[model samples]
Target: MNVFQSLVSSWQFWAVLSALAAALTAVFAKLGVKGVPPDVATFVRTIVILVFVSSLLFVSGQFSIVRSLSRRSVGFLVLSGLATGASWICYFRALDLGKAGQVASIDKMSVVLVAIIAFLFLNERLSMLATLGVLLISAGAILVAVAD
Candidate 1:
């Protein structure tokens, strides 16, 4: 099977797992900034992820995943990691400066950005309903941010 079919067929096995992972990420971040500075808390978070992932690699005998990455791939991985770190920093800073509802609402606007980027750069097409949905998401995000 192609990767997409493989994923769809196995999705019932992974859906809850993915949802739980998302929940843990949100909860941990909400709790993380409670006492710690957002930047340092973000650092602690990266360290925790590294520890957990490295342990999983060791325990699962998947060291080949770590070892097989080529130097160019390693550079791309590092760049992606840095970008994620920067996003986390900005996300927490937004939450630290504003309400969680507002920050999350604004963050969800990334969906619209991704859709537009895909359309522009990849020549992807959106249906009329999809275009309307993007506009609605953007409008809702603006209201969420501006609402008192």
Candidate 2:
């Protein structure tokens, strides 16, 4: 396979893309919330995301599965949505008040949190090396957040 095809096929590629997009989100959101209230900015961002994702679902014919989803699936999705909304509000507010890099650094501490949470609740296994990496990520995030 060509390099581009191989790269696009890997989960690592998508994760890297997500990281880059998140980095841009911090920069763009910091700028966007300059004069606006963070909550209001979050609302606007939510609307845009809703429209964009809805359109993508519609065009991809994925909207048809909405009614086929189980009640439990819907319930968890609702909870996830609530959590996402809360996180976005807090993230935007942090961006409004702090340095983008520092805010993003702390935000990325979610990685460590997820690793622990997954191991506890999702029965995911973490080897010693992975645990050490998580510890390093936590330390790095803390150091970056506290750095002048």
Candidate 3:
């Protein structure tokens, strides 16, 4: 495959896109939440996401698979949705009160937290290098959060 095809098929490409989108989200949300209650901002964001994702699923012909999801999958997805909502509320509130960079740095600490949690509960193994990277990410987040 050519480089473009290889990148299109790679998880890293999607992850990089996700990171870029998240960075923009922090900036846009910080500006957008001005004068609006954080909760209301979050609600509006949720509605937009719902509409976007629903439309994407419909267009991709994937909406029908929702009915095929196992009960366990549905239950976990529900829990994940609740957790995501709570995180967004807290993140929006933080962004309202703090610098965007500071708020985003703290929010990105979830990367380290996820590594640890996955290791503990998901039977995931981290190589020494990966563990070091996680530690560095935690330290960098702390530095960024406190630098302001």
The candidate that wins on lDDT is 3
lDDT (10s digit) by residue, model 3, range 1-148: 9999999999999999999999999999999999999999999999999999999999999999999999999999999999999999999999999999999999999999899899899989999999999999999999999995
Q: All candidates' TM-scores?
A: 0.74, 0.94, 0.97
At residue 115, what lDDT does model 1 achieve? Answer: 99
- lDDT accuracy of residue 42 in candidate 1: 82
Superposed model 2: Cα runs more than 4 Å off: 1-5
Q: In model 2, what lDDT does residue 114 have?
A: 94
lDDT (Cα, 0-100) at 102 in candidate 3: 95
What clash pairs does model 3 have?
none
| Top-TM-score structure, candidate number | 3
Model 1 stretches with alpha carbons more than 4 Å out: 1-24, 70-72
**Residue 75, candidate 3: how far off, in angstroms?**
0.5
lDDT of 3: 0.96
> Alpha-carbon error at 92 in model 3, in Å?
0.4
